[model samples]
Target: MLIVSGWIAVDPEAREGYLAGCRRVVEEARATPGCLDFVLSADPLEADRITVYERWASDAELAGFRGSGPEPEQTAEIRDAQVHKYRISAIEPP
Candidate 1:
């Protein structure tokens, strides 16, 4: 399993608009094969932040769905981000 988690910074005023624009991508990701879950949400404490999380069944699946990443126009709006991919070796009751 794999998990991608992080947060992104954007203009406070443009934050809602940015998240709105991501609706389609988020929808598509949730529909894709091997995608366990995908989410992009506005942070409660940070007006300019968006929290991101995604889960995939395997590396191949994640790579296939990540084709080309976010659009350039969308990427341009991100002022800063800290995202990371984690490879999970096992899972147990949490």
Candidate 2:
């Protein structure tokens, strides 16, 4: 399993607009095969923060869905990000 998780920072006032623009991405990702979960959410205490989390069955599925990542215009909106990918070796009850 592959897990992609991180947070991003944008202009406080522009945060909502940035997330609103991701509705399609969220919907499409959830519908894709091998996608276990995908989400982009606002940080309750941080107006400039957006939390990102995604789980995929494999690298191929993630790559197939992610293609080239955010569009240029959207990429330009982000001021910073701290995201990372993890390869899970085992799973157990949480």
> Which pairs of residues have clashing backbones in candidate 2?
none
**Residue 77 displacement in candidate 2 (angstroms):** 0.5
RMSD to truth, every model: 0.7, 0.6
Q: Candidate 2 lDDT (Cα, whole model)? A: 0.96
Candidate 2 C-alpha error for residue 40, in Å: 0.2
- For model 1, what is the alpha-carbon lDDT of residue 28? 95
Q: Write the per-residue lDDT of candidate 1 for residues 1-94, one digit (tens) a residue.
A: 9999999999999999999999999999999999999999999999999999999999999989899999998999999999999988998999
Looking at model 1, residue 10 earns an lDDT score of: 98
Q: Estimate each model's TM-score.
A: 0.96, 0.97
